[model samples]
Target: MFCFLRKLHKMESTWPHSLQFLLFFSLLFSMAFSKSVIEPCNSSTSCNSLLSYLLPSDMKLAEISTKFNINPIELVGSNNLDQQTSQTLILSAKTTIKIPIQCPCINGIRQSVSTLYTVQPIDTIESICTGFGNLVSPDQIKAANDLDNSSSSLESGQSLKIPLPCTCFNNTDNGVTALYLSYVVREGDSLDSIAGAYGTTVTDLVGVNKLGSPSIDPGDILAIPISACSSANMNLYNDSLLVPNGGYALTAGNCIFCSCGPRNLSLHCVPSALSASCPNLQCKGNNLFIGDVEEELMGTGCNVTTCLYRGYVNHKVLSSLSNTYRAQCTSNHSNPLSPSLPPSSIGIPSVHVLPSLAPAAAAPFAGHGFGSGPTAVQIASSATVSTRTSNSAPFILVFLLALMLVFIPFDPNVYS
Candidate 1:
């Protein structure tokens, strides 16, 4: 009887330890397979951040959960799969799957940074979000914009803000670190100027932006890599080294000079005085003429004299950098006499001109010989008349043909 009692007591003692071991491993297993929780946006309760993933082939629910470190049950519920449980079920091939992305939250509000995106023609919210790797959900976008429904259409040229997940890099403190700033390229900006202004190199800018070439168009938003020099440190005159050639710099609270040079090569500054003397000329009623000017500017200098005789007058002066002056020129007289002057004589060299104008348009006073209002206005009026005549040629031809047909006798006999 004593032996039996002893054996029973020993079993009771071991029972507690067995239970403890099981509980300990249960905690560990839960921790190992735990998934990130989707946070709510500050403004809306329905907003949930998500990421889209394209499956290469058909995969089982359990397999996907395991691969992405998500709970099988949660995955099934979130995706609305037909499966009732977290069992092995095959999902269709090429299926776009939505995975919940974790976002930083403060006081129950998500802290996500966003940038503006201009909607292009035929662009849908789903398509735009998908293009961005699904870092944001359709619902989140709708909530951010306060749209009535997700099915609402977007018009071309409309802008939308897109949110992105913030990541904390552990090695940022010790390694080469850079902060990104959003910049819009203006009419006179070049990659070299942008890099110099921000205290970074053109190579880094191109790499970060993934630009096919150094050329950038107006209204293009560039992700500028800024390592040092904030808004307070920008100085134009004394900091000539920081200003790109053909690009302007701010000095004494004003933008001064034009930094210009060869594309993708070293640049030099052109005196504002010389640039002012260069004529603004555009070919009347000819987009082709403007294209020629752009092409020539890309090469060496503007053929001011030839362009002037072609009825090209500058409408507006864009910027004078290096030896080239970019302007909107127009001429009233169409088919003007072409001059026999050599190309060299027509093209103004950078060395002959003097620098004077400050880059800032709002500068207190104009530079020496900067403003030429009456002459410019007279040229523009003449150019407008010529442009109108050229534009009406096709209409005139059509009208003349119609009149001829009305006067002619019936052509039924010819058809027979």
Candidate 2:
């Protein structure tokens, strides 16, 4: 410690004031690196999950949605915003948002496969690490990118691989379709408080994580379960899905889109009128298209038949017809038959990692059906934003060091 103090004294005299500040700040902050969130994946069944993203700068919802390849509607609804919230609205920097992704076991770990970050001139490895709310580790980033100690500077425009935290514990929890979110534990966050915010129970959480005790620490990643409006996809190409209760999923090679609502836990699938050319979506002899419905009142109630999206097969859309009770007009059905629940232990498809459990039960969700977009849910934010911060830490340390360098003379003789 004394030798380091003497080195600081020498640098203080030789370096100018500005250099002194920069050097001291970098040295102090770089000493302590943040820990990575921990959740392992060993299951074959894949499911949807959420990644808590801290915005690096002011950005529009549409741009972010496009960057993540998600429907604008799902992005808005996931944040508990109005379905009609303009895509161009600029959200502030430092605001944390949940990003839904498919988490499958990749080489023994559960993580979404392909999230990339482009280097900027002003970005140091430390800044990039903090930009992700410290959920990402500097060492992980360096290991993934094969980077050296020169993190203070980097070649602009180079892409960096981000190994995000996520899970898919068989996509069901306590016998219902679920979405799992990788939530980082925070200080002052009791287990019950975390459970209550997302409308789940502490027992379910403890069981899902296979914990021996209820104790948790900051930076630990817990697989949080969220009940989803279930999917009954026929597994046409391994693209099975179950959307988080207010979110949307684009499937069938973008020819079909699905959304889930709080009304009865059904997945509403439809022909997305986006520029992609879809296969013939007509219900033969029924004068209907995917998501289209026809209703006739029976003696006691209503008899409804609708066209549904099953899955994409051989580049052809697989759809079927149902003659069941009046389904909330899809323009979608079914609390999908439950997959055999895996033993509770561990954990996306944003395809939902966590939910505000659901939205308030509303009118039978008569959806946009064709082009405008799916209905939004008034569900609350499911993942908790991390409370860790250190923007002023470097400055504070540098200030204190400056005082020590001048006022406290180093005793080289005593050290010798």
Given candidate 2, what's the lDDT at residue 367?
20
Q: Which candidate is the best by TM-score?
A: 2
Instruction: Report every candidate's CA lDDT.
Output: 0.37, 0.58
What is the number of residue pairs that collide in model 2?
16
**In model 1, which range of ten residues has the least summed lDDT?**
382-391
Q: In model 1, which runs have C-alpha deviations exceeding 4 angstroms? A: 1-175, 228-416
Candidate 2 local lDDT, residue 348 = 20
Which regions of candidate 2 fall more than 4 Å away from where they truly are?
1-47, 62-87, 148-158, 186-188, 209-218, 233-239, 252-255, 273-281, 292-302, 313-318, 325-416
lDDT of 1 at 27: 38
Model 2 residue 371 lDDT score: 20
